[model samples]
Target: MNSNKDIWVFGDYRNYFQNRVTLQILARAVDLFSTTGSSVCAVVFGRDVDEYVAEYIAHGAQKVYVMDDPALNTYSIETYSWLMSHLVKLYKPETLLVGATRFGQEIAPRVAKKLKTGLTADCIDLELDEKGRLVQIAPSFGGNLIAKIITPVQRPQMATIRPGTFQELPHDYDAKGEVICLPVPEDLPKDAIRLITSERRPSEKQKIEDADIVICGGRGMGSKGKFKKLFELAELMNAEVGATRPVVYSEWASHDSLVGQAGKNIKPKILLSFGISGAIQHTSALMGADFIIAVNKNPNATMMKMADLAIVADANQMCLGIIKAIKEKIRT
Candidate 1:
């Protein structure tokens, strides 16, 4: 278990390329492990998964183990857990990283339990301790403190990283690596649950993380009535509405609409934050935004400092004014 050590980044694949989270993990693992004399390998599963091996290689993985199986195409807890557990037993990787999606969260714990290992989920930062062990850093106590968790004795230190927590490596078409095709193990169990139908909602109403434009509200919005103005402005702009932790805890918005270190990372084309003070816990995830416009009454707010445009004004009146002006323009 100790001699053949390597970093294994689970390449969570969607309909298109490997999910962005996997690449982010790969980029990070490559940066840390390559110098420590550990190779980076991507473990990908799906029907025809080999097609993605080269793409992963370009993103800095030295090797890829592709599990191409019809049964593994869609996410099945039973199938994924068994295969990964078997692989870990055979190879005994030093580190196993999974993207913290609903699928990763489900399968990671199962696989870790099977291997008698420890797992740290939703980590915001990562570091290598002096012992060369992985350090999993995440928010704690309502983002007041940063907690570092490590599995000191575990052979394969496992963790699930939040999406948008890190940047992706630039693709290098000329880069090359080894690709291994894995066959479906004979004893893998069949999935009891099945997916029947699916639908894609319009971006305006889609998940906040996937939205192109995001309008976020904070505690300074004052009350529920005032917070509702964010939605009105969002409707006019065809954007998604997001909230800071305080706003969500106040029941002004749903948990899915929350953004930041503990919630979700958002990198929209346009990010308009209203009344947000912009703590590091909240601002860390907004790294992907192309244009940031932060509105807060306090000129010294962190959000204002990070924003391309900072407005020292009342958020409610500004939102109402924008909505009214947009409506008037539409009439013309």
Candidate 2:
């Protein structure tokens, strides 16, 4: 509880398999150890969380601080905030990292407020300054510009990183780490909000982040009618459909399918862009695409310039042609 210079990551494993943000942050924290010279640690609060502790070690955590108790069986924002803030005070860690998931968004700010520290939210990248201070990079002015922030005055610099921003380290079963169990304070106060019941409602739609191939459409597709054809193409090619903000706002696509700074970041192996102008907000999220094929009438469009293969043509016509080609290939 007294390691003042260690980098700490909060373990969020509720959607352990589906949501890998916690592990991703842990990997990034581990990378920082070389520059910051701080031990990479994870703090987990849950019941029967030995598996998660071990997983953290395999994923690059040098040590883990666990608070295992029946009281932590369910997540309570107030209770979690109080406990996390208390832990920060006790440990005095130099930096704390949390995933920018909904759960993290709710708890991180409260803990920062309690400890009188600054927190940067939804950071796209993290690095150390010349003085070894944490530099948090995120979008500003509605994704028009990027900002690098540092909590120079705070003891525990805090930040919530966007999901899919970084890749997790591969599991190493032979990795060694120390696990120190911490006792939950007996004087913990009752939470103001209580969870009466919980239910699981999983989405059947493919998450764009997990997609190997992505078919992305933009407002240049003209109307909702033309935009809907991307789904057919996606199905034919076994790809996920992504949309630019303008297309989503025009009701041509659902918000869930949006790819932008405000939406989900995707790192698809292959990305096919249709009629997109490549606004930075949309382009920034797909920077990790391994191969890009862009179809647009304007050869000078940003998307076309960024593509590995740019085709100058009507997006709708190209989409229909690709679909036809796929069907013919399947029949043969």
Candidate 3:
């Protein structure tokens, strides 16, 4: 494996229109592989993808491969997989990365099978070994251990990384990249999955998955009423609310708010955990936070041991006191 080859990122777009997580991953990939002399390229497919070429360049993509066609407006498993397979075959990149979103989960395995290559899913970290092979690290055996995966025989080492697992560099408007327009084949099988009209439901006020500041509660929250105070404090700070797995399973909060190995991984600027005994699984997922504050009745709890600020107190009263202090600061 030569270190001079390029690294490709699948710039997955949602319905050819909205949010894209690949740009963030691409930024991190650029930084990770920059010293190896491997430039980062992004592959985007859509109807009018020309409009997004500059966006990819701003995110540190050295080249943008655009596959524009009307048939690509909606996601078709067959079309997407075929297109990616073609790109992988054509470019022959040393490494390929895709976000482990729903769409990626659907397409990546299929592409890997088509290419007859190995893939590591839900990878948390990536690096290159002495042989210039990709070293993909992901949680394995229910988060009990970290596994380092490598594809020595595969032409392009493929991996699907979780969103929020990597930090993106600031967008540089003056960053430059080449845009290559690819042709989408006109003769393709009709999509088996039909897209009916889509509908949006009223979602929660704040989503823990995307929050910059998160306050989480756990089993030691005592009762549902006490757990609710976490949300009050979260609201006062205009932050998002989260919980450990036990809190969600016990019905103190919904499953979407759960954060841990079995739940969503969050990289907040500040993470505050109340009454939580941090299991290794939960702590591994949140150790990337810039700052962590843990409060528990037991001073020896795992969370208290690892937290920057550990407070031994009644969890409920401490949360209320913090909320009051925040409110007073806002008023003054």
* Leading candidate by TM-score: 2
TM-score of each: 0.60, 0.61, 0.58
TM-score of the candidate numbered 1? Answer: 0.60
RMSD of each: 15.0, 14.6, 14.3
- Runs of candidate 1 exceeding 4 Å displacement: 1-3, 15-18, 194-332
Candidate 2 at residue 139, lDDT? 94
The alpha-carbon deviation from the true structure for residue 131 of candidate 2, after best TM-score superposition, in angstroms, is 0.3
- lDDT per prediction? 0.84, 0.88, 0.81
lDDT tens readout by residue for model 1, 1-332: 46266899887866233247888889999888777989999998887666567778978899998888777767767878888988998888999999998889998999999988989888997899999999999887888988999888877899999988988788777888988887888877767888786432223447788889999999988898789878767766879998999998998887878898989999899999999999888998899999999889998999999899999999888888888787555423
lDDT of 2 by residue, 29-129 (tens): 87877665689999999899998898889889999999999999998888888999988888889998999999999999998899888999999999888
Q: Write the per-residue lDDT of candidate 3 for residues 51-79, one digit (tens) a residue.
A: 56766787789988888888888767888
Q: Let me know the TM-score candidate 3 reaches against the reference structure.
A: 0.58
How would you order the candidates by TM-score, starting with the best? 2, 1, 3
Question: Scored by Cα lDDT, where does model 1 land?
Answer: 0.84
